[model samples]
Target: MSTLPRSLLKNLDLFRSVSEHDLDTVLQIAQTMRLQAGEPVFQQGQVAENFYILLHGHLKVVQTTPEGEQITVRYVMPGEVFGIARAMRRPTYPAACIAVEESIVLSWPSSEWDHVIARNPQFAFNALQTVGQRLQDAHTRIKELSTEEVEQRVARCILRLVDASGEQTEEGVSINFPITRQEIAEMTGTTLHTVSRLLSSWKEQGLVNTGRKRVTVRRLDDLIRLAEGQPPGGTAASKRNSVEPL
Candidate 1:
């Protein structure tokens, strides 16, 4: 049996509606896992034996192409449930989930999925809601990739990260995590060189402050304007300078 507090599960979105009795039932099956940065919780195409709910820290879901290139699909925050290949009726996971920082997760055997849902209606509802939201996000990403310019995509990606994990600080709104330019490239479907150059230009224009694996938005309004396809400086020449051939 897991030694973690029972109240911890209650705080998670997946278990928020579950009653005390149902929570106890879930705790009986859950196994706690600790992971270091760069460790994969599950690899792409692995048999999905367990579904997990992150208790703490961040993770990134990545999919590898046949040509061996990796693309980041999304970032997972605490309280989010993941790795439900069984629920999706898939034999194996479609992507890999890797810890972006030191993290903790609670996992239950895939075999127990039906039993748990059969007994806990609220949990079943919550699980379905989670799956629906993810599908919507995936569709949104597909749309962005199909139509948006690289510059707009990069700006929008940063904004999404900020929405997920941004923290207010003396240095404006900080992303509050270690995210490298290469990872940003993967998320935005651009080259690392392109992300670096755009960031450098934004910095010179006093829109952001960046360091190794860190980014802080100093001028949120200007960045939003750029993301919306408007010139940051409200001029035609500024718009021309903002976009470059990839």
Candidate 2:
């Protein structure tokens, strides 16, 4: 827990502006927890009694449809605070947070939220900013779902994840966490079969590579063009991208 103190928080926008004295108080109340890959951090509709900060690793914020389909809203990266229902004045979490990889989390009782905010006005402003950004992202996704084609939505989702947690590789940019096409379907409001067909076509087009639980963007420019409206189908992984018949 040595790393859980205020010094590390200086890198975080939410806490960087907090006074040393006020940050120390937050440190005093902070509790740390670890979760294994594929573990549930919190279930949907659970009492949002605490605020959580991701110190290490990634998670997915998801909601389940009435038919039991999982809809992935977004990925939670390290240094981000989650389970924000407390700040939003919600009694329960609207979605589940699941660890996509092994994770370390810092938590604080929601009862102490107001105390921390009063001590550090910047904290409140930061929280508002975080919530506002989240809402804005939600709005963007809603607009995409309603207006964009499925191919466009999936392409945008993959590109965003790439920007969020991608690592450079000889092959291209690989997502740092394990992800399946089914999850992509959930994120894009499509079916597994549809996602598979598109990915298979993308693979042929030399835009992406897929493995057991991985996806790598082999040609981002091509993918961006495809996402924008170009069809997919090609023979070689060429810098010159085109949509040929599979």
Candidate 3:
């Protein structure tokens, strides 16, 4: 835990302003778990006995409706703290967290949730900040789904991914994580066919390049124009009354 503490806590927002000594103590109680791709870290409605921090790889937070449809709430990158049901005042997990690839996470028992918070003032503030940001992002996604066209929604979804984990490439910015059109559709409240068609058109227009589990933005400005509800060559107002495809 001594060696792991400095490197893991250095860049994490949850550990903002935390002392190296305090972080070391917290890491001592954490248990590490490694998951394979498609494996679930926790299921919705499961007893929330622990909270977790993603140490490596990616995860998708998903919720299933009574109709058996799954909605992708968001993607979790490394350094994210999740499954904090105690923070939400819930006794069970609100959604399922599944690994997008091979991953590692450090988890602590829920019993320590209060002690951890009390031990570090900055941790509480950082935790609340993370939760607040998630709330804001949810609002923005809802607004986009309610008001934007399919193409606009798709574009915004990709842009969000690009902002989160994109890496510079010779061609343009590439989403560093593996993602598929189906997952994009789930995130944007659309269908796979619609997502595929939009990506295909964008590829043909030289705005993006897409392949199996990969997407690279070739012309970011043009993509932003589309996301803003203005085509690359024309201006258009956002369709406020439009409903996203099911």
State which candidate has the highest TM-score: 1
Ranking, TM-score, top scorer first? 1, 3, 2
Q: TM-scores of the models, in the given order?
A: 0.91, 0.89, 0.90
| Model 3 poorest ten-residue lDDT run | 237-246
Q: Candidate 3 lDDT, tens digit per residue, 58-98?
A: 99999999999988889998888889997789999999999
Off by over 4 Å in 3: 1-5, 233-246
Quality of model 2 by C-alpha lDDT: 0.83
**TM-score of candidate 1 relative to the true fold:** 0.91
Candidate 1 Cα deviation (angstroms), residue 208: 1.4
**Alpha carbon deviation, residue 195, candidate 3 (Å):** 0.5
Q: Give residue 184's lDDT in candidate 3 (0 to 100).
A: 94
lDDT of 2 by residue, 1-246 (tens): 335756777778778887787787788888888999889889999999898889888898999888996788888888887887977889999999999889999888888888878887777787777789898988988999998998998898898898888887777888888898888998888999999999899898678889988999888776777677786444454545432221
- Cα RMSD for predicted model 3: 6.2
Tens digit of per-residue lDDT, candidate 1, span 1-246: 679888888877667778888789889889999999999999999999999989899999999999999988888888887999998999899999999999999899999999888977877887898899999988887888899998899999888888888887766788887899999999888899999999999988877789989998877767888899888763555433442211
Using lDDT as the measure, the top candidate is 1
**Per-residue lDDT for 217 in model 2?**
89
**Between 1 and 2, whose lDDT is larger?**
1
| Candidate 1, lDDT over the whole model | 0.86
| TM-score of candidate 2 relative to the true fold | 0.89
